[model samples]
Target: LWSSIIKSKNKTYYLGYFWDKETAAQVVRIKRLELHGEFANHG
Candidate 1:
């Protein structure tokens, strides 16, 4: 469910700039992964 939400948000950014979809998606995915990793490591 949360994954879907993230994907949708990325899609919105992608729609704003066609060439940035991949980069934006990668950035978003990486940020989310980093956040999850930090929470898992400390919490």
Candidate 2:
């Protein structure tokens, strides 16, 4: 699992902090799927 929390200027941003290869891969896969879905829906 990847997770990160950053606070700056009262704004918080969470960044990837992958713990393992599998987790990183899963994140990438999910992101790709989401992008694909968005493109399919819009195009």
Candidate 3:
């Protein structure tokens, strides 16, 4: 199984796992409401 996590300036959050990075990124972005400036090149 695959797993992903986000270690932003605020804190570290678990974004679960998926078949692709895109899916993991999407979940990360959604959970990451503290910062919007950066998110896996989602600028």
Candidate 3, residues 6-41: lDDT per residue as tens digits?
777677877687998777777777766546555445
Candidate 3 similarity to native, TM-score: 0.49
Tens-place lDDT digits, model 2, residues 17-39: 78776766565556545545555
- On residues 1-43, what C-alpha lDDT tens digit does candidate 1 reach at each position? 0121233334432213234556655556665565565553321
Worst 10 residues of 2 by lDDT: 34-43
Error of 3 at 19 (Å): 0.7
TM-score of every prediction relative to native: 0.40, 0.46, 0.49
Q: Compared to the true structure, candidate 2 yields what TM-score?
A: 0.46
Candidate 1 vs candidate 3, lDDT winner: 3
| Comparing 2 and 3 on lDDT, the stronger one | 3
Q: Which stretches of candidate 3 lie over 4 Å from their true place?
A: 8-10, 34-43
The model with the greater TM-score, 1 or 2, is 2
Top candidate by TM-score: 3
| Least accurate 10 contiguous residues by lDDT in model 3 | 34-43
Model 1 misses residue 23 by how many Å?
0.3
